[model samples]
Target: MGSHWSAASRARALASATRLWRGSLSQPLLTWALVLLTVVASVAVVTTGNWVPVSVLILIELLGAFLLRLRGMVVLCSVIAAECVGMVVARSEAFNPGEMLVQGVSIVALLAFAFHREQLGLQGAPGGLMLVDLRDRLAAHGRIPRLPAPWRVDSALRAAYAEAFSGDFVVASTAERGTLLEVAVVDVSGKGQAAGVRSLLLSGSFGGLLGAMPPEEFLPAANDYLLAQDWDEGFATAIHVSVDLSTGEYWIVSAGHPPAVQLHAGSGRLDIIDSIGAPALGVVSDLRCVPVTGRLLPGDTLMLYTDGVIEVPGHDVEMGIDRLMGAAERMLSTGRGGAEAVLAAVRASEGDDRALVLVHRDQS
Candidate 1:
């Protein structure tokens, strides 16, 4: 038994050492190794009398700036500086003043880039990769899950100024064994990148809250969350909808958002759901949201949108709603890409973010 335990301990130690060595290959260890190689190469160039150009060493230092952490970067820069001095002292005849000036400028630019990245708490390509991952995750949260055969849902969001991030976002989930579908459309106070950070934070929080608890409790919890942030421009508007996929029964709760529009297929007329109302989130404490309930029959459609769709500068919000209804009518009548088509046809405010969601019950 003692012999067996000792053998197992040796195997474990080997495994751990292997893991550590593999991990170090990508970071500081790799950087330090490169630094040492560069130093040797620099020494060879000085001893051999201009066989390898000093410019090549400068390029290696630039590469190190991208790959190394702050400490490693500082060490690499110091090595490069020392090599520069050595080249000037040993090979003064070959070193041109113009080339030295350009190399000096390059080093300064590299240092500036390193410091800027350090300020963001991340450096190099990893920071950009992290943001891409975040954006993709945020987009994934808004994806509507597949519903029953009779239900069709689609949504679209556009940022102001064609920016990569938007102030408007959606979160949705289905619960009760896929019999209940809940969706929330949220609009942060500012437009485009100005409010994107807050939008990202709220989307994750609201997405977690959507199907975790009773649908009725989501808004209040979200409100409490936003209020806790205590930001100067923290308030936001949102509309939450819960639908019974089996029965077509739905309950909508609003937080100072634009009224939802419903298309009655039988009458071929549009009606606004205006009863559900509450103050904007984060603006009030002890808020109570009263939900308005309804049912969708075969061939019926429900549309939810942000205020940017209707808020024209000179016109009242009512006119914008009317205009939206007209554009929606034309877009839905075509029966091809309802959500994307309506967003394209509708003339929304140019300077604000816009989003739209469409849910339809197909006729049997």
Candidate 2:
């Protein structure tokens, strides 16, 4: 582990240095210095009566300054090299091989610098130059968003095996001016980038729907939105929860998602709340959901999970749920592990994506 970390650190350092060096070549000061050096060498060659080489070099430099392209740099260097060879072979009365050599070397060096800079720029960032913007956008829609106080929420979404983006989970939370808190978790039908793209595209629309209407209307609205897309062989399951912060009354609705487990503060018992809505969104028209209503007292915790949490190859989902309940009961009661440990216990395989959302009602 330590050696792997050391190697990764060294790689990052090298990448950063290469990026900086490439950037410095384009800076005004260094660029002007190179241009000045070329011009001075050109003047010395001109003094030696080799006006042709001088003119060609100046023209190449001027074009380079204007275009600043990779192909342009290559052409400039080739021209300079050819000019130097011509000066050496001609042996004319005005030919100065020394000055031409200097000019050729300078142009070649500049071309090499530019080439390196371009290569570094391409290879530097992990997800390319727009990664920062991409991260900001994903964090807005995919990550666990803000929730009201007295409710500590912990959630995680992991991609399928050998994938960079998770396909199963989309968590979005919004509070309506301290009165109502809304959260939605959606799982697309597939795994990997294809499903991830759908999740990304739908995140903004789904988030808007969560907060756009009353608590009961949120699921139906989402169903309508999904049906409108009319994607062939495409469907999604989701859970939407709205909580009244003042009274602690919460309503949870689902669209073909797995049941949520609620931990009672009084009895320390775990109860699985079944899905009360219609089938998965986008499957049928005129969708309606029966919202499951419950009251969350102080110290109670509710866990919302995708099917990945309780699925194994040969065993039943009920068995997986039992395993999760057992692990969560032991971990939550002892205050040792939170949502992450619960996930570790219930995780069956890497063939599918997994997501978990834990909303703990803190004791006042």
Candidate 3:
């Protein structure tokens, strides 16, 4: 009963969110609704000298704008709405021709500007929808495998920025013969939109690269592509790993990115597989990415991450690494060490993008 109630509640919340999201996407309807509400509420409130309704309407407009990130429409609507509400609240029934004229002009100008902004793409893409698409791409759902049943791979990523686009890990996964699995975690250099766009552009190609070639060649090809672009100050760090599910043989390639950490199933020992490669991609040409071999026996877990997990300000990288190892040990011992759990163990710094991937060999 408890689970059923919880499920119902979640469904309602999702429905509400979906409606609100759809409303924001309907530009014509949203814009006209705001305009009509503001105009009607303003005129009614002013004529009746009742400010309460107008005030409430303004609050609703503000709430919608805040929730939807509709900056332009909200700003204009609030200004006009407040003007109407204030006139009524002040008990000024005498309609000042000048004041009314100014607001009328303001409303028209605002609507024109809003329409122009939309047409010119000055308003930018809606963050909510863009984030949804980005989240799906970052995870690469259909491309990743959850094979052999109960034994599964789990991953999570978080961006510090509100837009949810970041320079964190770019993930791509594939399985061969339903037994061999390959995954890559790449970190594009830089942050915010510049890095976000580059990461998006590279993620597609990298996804194909990870699936099309051997683990060792992934980084070399990635480096070649980056060098080809010849960007003045852009590079990327990455780790690519391929695993034989049946035999537990794993081959890893690192390109100036942090290593993959593994936990020994029998001894509860932790090992960090550091990156042994040339500088990060784009730094130089003809880069050779050395493959690191390891084994994941049943019950063992392997972890991959972006530098944002470590490299905390005022703290050395080694301390951050040690923090992760210690956290992983405790969580794994308690059967709570999932990808997100380990990431939470190491508190993130403000304005840093982070990502983590975990592959656990289920106990037989």
Candidate 4:
């Protein structure tokens, strides 16, 4: 009986140790362990005839800026102390004043950077990680769902200055058990990073509203949402499209956005869709949006785009539209590259964010 009890006790102890070991691998604890190891390495380097360069210790502390939070100060101090020890142990001829000055300047520069980063209310590299997470979430919200084989959809966005974040975004959904496709193309007021925060927030809200309620209700609800924010530069333009995949019936709703273009495969003609009209979102209260109805027969293509694709300095929007239409005609006729090619061919300037959404009904 005693032997059995002893075996059970051993098993419990082993489990506890395993848990403790795993727990020690978490943050702050892991950082502390790294600090301790750095200190040990510093000592070993100094005592072992200073074989390793002191610059190596400085490099470790520099890396700590990205990995450590408030603990980075401890690493800085430890490395400075290690350098001092190395200087003392080295032969008198080996102590170069120029090298020491350079090291001191590098350490001071690192300290200044750390203080600046702290003032921004960020710890380590969390700001960058947070931005990455935001970008991914926005992209996820914009991702188009898989559609039936007869229909194909593609979208592209380019931020002003080639930034990672854009003012323009596309969010899509399939409802009615995959018989309907709903896509919303939006362009927030500002460009690139200046509008990235607002863009991310609206993308999430708009994605939720799309396909969650009736198609006609999306823009009015989105307008109400934007009005609630009451921001000075809060207005935005958008095009919401709801299509019946099986029947080729569709509705186009515009909120002060540039018109959508439709390609009639049978006639080989392009028609600009600008019938539906409403104020830009957040511009007015009690907003009501009426959609323009249309049909997309087999081999037909519908294109939606933001103003950035057409607008340029010293030119009216009409001219830009004409240019876009010509490019679209060429692209549709050849059937070569997809949305990216059309955007590349039609964009007037890189001064603003551009986005394009193309929906094509395959030839039957």
Best candidate, TM-score: 4
Candidate 2 lDDT, 66-98, residue by residue in tens: 335455466556655665565556555565667
* Residue 288 miss distance in model 1 (angstroms): 2.1
Ten-residue region with minimum lDDT total, candidate 4? 2-11
Query: Model 3, 207-315: lDDT tens per residue?
Result: 7777677667788898888888777767988888888888888888888888889988789999998665667888878788777898898888888888888878898
Worst lDDT run of 10 residues, candidate 2, spans 122-131
All candidates: TM-score: 0.77, 0.65, 0.71, 0.79
The true-structure Cα RMSD of candidate 1 reads: 8.3
Scored against the true structure, residue 67 in model 3 reaches a CA lDDT of 38
Tell me the tens digit of each residue's lDDT in model 4 across 1-364: 5443343454455456445534553546656666676676666655665476556657766776665655555565565666555665664455567667766777677777777777765556545544556677777788889988789998888899899899999999999999999999999999999899899999999999999999989999999999999888999999999999989999999899998999899998999987458999999887778789999999999999999999989999899999988888888768977789888988569889999989999998
Cα error, residue 133 of model 3, in Å, equals 2.9
Which run of 10 residues does model 1 get worst, by summed lDDT? 2-11
Note the clash tally of each candidate.
Answer: 0, 0, 0, 0
lDDT of 1 by residue, 297-335 (tens): 888899999998889998899999999999988878557
> lDDT per model, in order?
0.84, 0.71, 0.70, 0.81
List the pairs of residues colliding in candidate 3.
none
Can you tell me which runs of candidate 1 are displaced by over 4 Å? 1-22, 33-62, 78-109, 123-126, 192-194, 312-319, 347-351
Candidate 2 lDDT for residue 189: 85
